[model samples]
Target: MVVLGFMFISCYKGRLLPIEGKVKFNLIKSDTYTLLYMETEKGYPNFNLTIEFNLIQHGKTVKVELLGVYELHILLPAFGPARGIDSLMLTNGLNNLLFTYGSYTDYYAVQVDTCIHVIPIITKFTVYDSTLYGGLVRKPNIYLYPTSPCSVIVKLSPNGRLVKTIPDYDDGFKVYAYPDGSISGTPGYLFYEAEIRDVDLGTNGWCVSQPEIISFLQWLLPEYGFNPRECDDFIQYWGDKLTGSPYYEIYPITLEQIDLICP
Candidate 1:
C-alpha cells in the first residue's frame, strides 16, 4: 500500500535536470484593528503582531503559533486559488502565512504565528512518467529548511480544516529563508529535503479511487466550482477515505460532506 501517497513507480530524470521554482510568498491578510495598526507612531517596523489569531469568545487569544506545517498534492494540476494568492511572498512583517504547496486545488495551508515557516523547494530532477515519456513531470529530491526542532503533527480535513494537532516542544521547527530566495529549516521532522513540483498530500481520512484520483479530478478541474469548499478544498478537508469512504471520481461530493464528520 502507498502509505504516504507516493507511488512506487519508476521515475525518470528528464530534461531540465533539477527543474526549480522559488519559494514564492505574498501577504494573505492582516487586521487593521490589531496592534499592527495601533503602533504606527513608533514607525511601521516597530509594529509587533503578537496576536496570531483573533481574540475569541473566550476573551483570550489562543496563543497560537504554528510549530510545523505541511501539505500534499498531485504531481501537477490541470488547472486553481484566487488572484495573487498564488504568487511567492516576502511579508512586510515577520509574520505571514506560508503557502507550502499550491496548484489546481491549493491543497496546503498553515496558520503560522511568525510567517517564517517557508519551505522553498530546490528540485533535484524532473521525474516524468517513465514508459511513454510525456505529459507531466515532477521535481523530486528537493531540499528545504532552516527549521526548528518542535513536533506539532496537525491533520486537516482537506479543505484546510484542522483534523488533529499533536505538538512536542522538542519536536518543533523554526523555518526561515535564505538570501537566494530559497528557504531552509530543520522541521520537527526531517524536512531538510523536499520536492519542487506538486506532490501527493496523502489518503488517510477521505475516500478516493487511486486510479481515478488524478484523471477524475482533472476532468472536473476546469469547470467545477461551488461553495467555499469544493474540489480540492473538499478533498483536503475530508481527505480520502480510501476505497470505501466517498468516491469523488464516480460522483463529485458536495460541501454537505462536512456534516458527515460532525459529533
Candidate 2:
C-alpha cells in the first residue's frame, strides 16, 4: 500500500463540488490474479459515479472508464493475447512491483472528473518455505520507548519458524517499558530471525556507491525516526559487505509491509 496525497472535488446532484480529504492505493495479490484497490475518505455517499482508470508504464498509457462505481477493485484485463498472471507480469508491468519478495513500485493512476492522481506504489512480501523452514530475515531488533513506565507485550506472527529470539518469545515478550527506551528483566533491545525454506531476490533497487551509501543512510535513517546511535549501528552492521562492490542495490521495506509479512 502507498498513499500519494492529493485533494479532489466530489460530484453530487449533477454539480461539481470541492471536498477536502485523501485517498489510498493498494495492490493486492490473490491465488487467481492481482488487483488494484482504491479508496477515499470522503466518497460519494448515496450514489456512484463514472471513473476513468489510467495506467502508465514504459512511456505508454492505457485508459479505461467505468460507469457507476464507488471504490475500485478490478482485475486488470489482458492487453493482447497475454492472460492471467503472465498478462499481469508482462504487459501491465506488474512484475516490476516485486522488487524483493513482495515489494513493488507504482505504475497506476486514477482520474475522476478533472482530477488526476499519479501514484507510486510500494509493497513487500516474504517467501518462506514452510517445508524446509528457510527465509533468512536479517537483523530485526525491537526498541521500546514509552512516555513512562508501562507493561508491554510484543508478539510476532512469522510465516515460518523463529531461529532466534531475545528473552525467549514464550508466545510473546512481556516486559516493563520505560521512558529511557529500556526494558526491565530483558536486554535493552529485542532481536530475532524468521527463517523459511527459500528466498526470492529482486533485481530492482538503488545501485549506490560507497560514499553515497554512507551519505544516504546518514540522511535516510533519521527520516525514518532512527536516533543517532541506532542509525550508526545499522550502517556499521551492513557497511563493510556493501562497500565490497562498486555499487550495491538497496531495497527498503515499509513498516506497513513488514506488519503484513510478519505481523
Candidate 3:
C-alpha cells in the first residue's frame, strides 16, 4: 500500500491586514483534498510572500510518502496583500501522515490538508548481520587545515579505498597538483612564488646589477597586478643591483619542472 501527504506556506506584508488562516481538508475512506487561504491585513499596503509545505505517511515503513506526489499551487490577489492557496491529495494505501510548513515573510504562513485513502498491510521479516547480502559500509574522514607545511598521512581501507587520515600541522605551504601538470599554492604564497620566478629572469641568480630587468618588471607590474609582497624577491634583487652587485644568469623553466627550486 502507498500513502501520500502535502503541505504549503503563504506570506504577505502589513500590520492591519487579515492574516491568512490555516487550511483544512476532509478524508473520505482516508482520502480527500484540502485548500488553504491567507488574506492581506488592512494596514499593510504591499505584499511580498512565500509558501512551503510537506507531506508524510506512517505504516510499517514510515516513509515520507509525499516524496514527489505533493504539489504547491500559489494564488496572488490583484490588490492589497497577495493571497496564497495550497492543496494536498493522498491516494489509498499506507499508514499515518505528517505535514510541516514555513515561510519567509512575516505576513506569510502555511496550511496543512491531509487526505488518506486505503488500508495498510502487515508482514513479518527477519534480520541478521552475518547473513546480510551486501558488504559492510564505512565512512571516510576528512580533515581541513590552515595554509602551512606538515606531514600528510592518509590511510586506506582493506579494499585499498581511502579510509581516513590524521590532521597535523607544520611549517611551509601546501601545494596542489593539477591534472595538467601545473601546481598552485595558497593565496599569499602563490603570488610570492610567481613574483620570485619572474624576477629570477629564468635563471638561478638574483638581479644584483641589472637595472634594465628591474625597470622592465616595474613596467610589467601593471599588466600582472600581482600583490606587492609577492615581488619582495624582485625588489631585493634590484636593490642589490643598484649597490653595484648585479647577479645575472640565464635559466629556463618548463611547466613540467616548475617544482624544482634553484640551489
TM-score winner = 2
Write the residue-wise lDDT of candidate 2 on 1-263 in tens digits: 32111111121223323222332333333344334333333445322222223343343343212111222111111121110111121233323322211122223432222222234443222111113332346556678889989999999987557878878888898888898888887657777767532232334345556557778778767766778766766777555434333445555555554655466
| CA lDDT of each prediction against the hidden true structure | 0.24, 0.45, 0.27
| True-vs-predicted CA distance for residue 99, candidate 1, Å | 17
Considering lDDT, which of the candidate structures 2 and 3 is the better prediction for this target? Answer: 2
Model 1 ranges with Cα > 4 A deviation: 1-57, 74-206, 214-263
User: Which ranking of candidates, highest TM-score first?
Assistant: 2, 3, 1
Expressed as tens digits, the lDDT of each residue in 121-182 for candidate 3 is 32111011111111111111122243554433322222111112222212322444333323
The global Cα lDDT (0 to 1) of model 3 is 0.27
Sorting all predicted structures by lDDT, with the top scorer first, yields 2, 3, 1
RMSD of each: 24.0, 19.6, 26.4
- Predicted candidate 1 versus true structure: per-residue lDDT over 1-263, tens digit per residue: 21111221112211211102322222222222121110001111111111111221212111111111111122222221101112132333333222222231111222335432322233221111111110111111122233543323322222222212222113333334433324334222222122121222233233345556655544443444322223444344223322221232233323343222210
